[model samples]
Target: MAVTKRRTRRSKEEARALILEAAETLLRKGGPAAVTMRAVAGNLGITDAAVSHHFGTRQELLEALLHQGGRRLKDELNAALKEWRETKPSIQSLVDVIADVYADGAYSELALQLHLSGWRDRGSGLLNSVVDELHAMRTKAFAAGGRKRPSIQETRFAVGMMHQTLALDPLFGEDFRRSAGISSADKPSIKQRKEMWGAMLRAILEG
Candidate 1:
């Protein structure tokens, strides 16, 4: 009984740590495809069987990790929005928060994966649900105090721009800079990025 209890306790702790690390790595790198039992094993210096024993299946491991990441971002954004609201911040601040949600990181990476999967497997039925959730969030914001709403096409294009910002910006910058004989080592600042986001939001609003 003592041996079993000790093993159980260690297993839970190891699993918890493994999954948490896996989630952070996945967020920083790519999403589900970048995460694997072997990778976690390699990362934590554990056995594949140990990871498998804890996660059971790759799908389950992925779902759990994704869930954890989602919870973290949700908590972060919720706290930020609540604090901002208390200060009576303006509409642009709220728009920046919304834009930041779909900007980058694990959610954005996995979202692209899910979108591609949905295309390959039409019956998977994820794209529409995600679209609905985004729409609902937007509507809630509008009800809160948004001054305008873009048409469906405009909204779709605007969100597509935001969602792919990180991926596209570097590529766009590199090509343009290279053509101008400029090294791409010089990166834009956060202020520049925020200004770009604000400009995009403004364009959508004015559209």
Candidate 2:
């Protein structure tokens, strides 16, 4: 006679989290095309029905992934901003922080795919808080110097431009640079580009 072992059940939240974790792993390993229901279930030692039960469809899962990524970016940016406030507020540090997030290429590719699939942010405005913080900082600095303060709209536009450039850089920066005869070997270096963007943004804020 053999004794049977029973498996413990996971709570709903736990199951969903595990599923998302597995899906993200798959997304990072391959691209968005690799994050299938079957693949995620296989990674978690579960069934396809389990994933579908939690996320109804692949599109929903991808949307959740984007939301999770946005939350993570928000947290990281907030932490960096706190550190910047404690020390000197360098625009280069801020640009470096954002550039680091998209350096791996996974998030940028996923965002591109989702956008191509007609997926919209749906008013999430993930970077809105970041824009507000930057605006406040610039306003305070300008007032202290007796200079004209930049409008909130101007701050928003500047931040948006930085965000868009960083997001797209991981996907096409090399090619774009190569086309411009910048060399395919990162001759000017990514850090240089980030520094340039930072300087340009600072000028925008000050102007």
Best by lDDT: 2
Residue 111 CA displacement from its true place in model 2, Å: 1.1
Per-residue lDDT of model 2, residues 77-143, tens digit only = 8898789778977778888988898888898999999999998887656678678777888999899
- Candidate 2 local lDDT, residue 83: 90
Best by TM-score: 2
Write down the TM-score for model 1. Answer: 0.54
lDDT of 1 at 55: 76
- Tens digits of per-residue lDDT for model 1, 1-207: 456434334668767766667656855676567787788777876787978887787666765665565565456556655675577534355445544554554565554565565522233221233334445556666667764653555555655555456434432544765677856566556556667667766566443
Off by over 4 Å in 2: none
* Per-model TM-score versus the true fold: 0.54, 0.92
Assess the local accuracy of residue 122 in candidate 1 as a C-alpha lDDT between 0 and 100.
31
On the 0 to 100 scale, the lDDT of residue 48 in model 1 is: 79
Candidate 1 lDDT (Cα, whole model)?
0.57
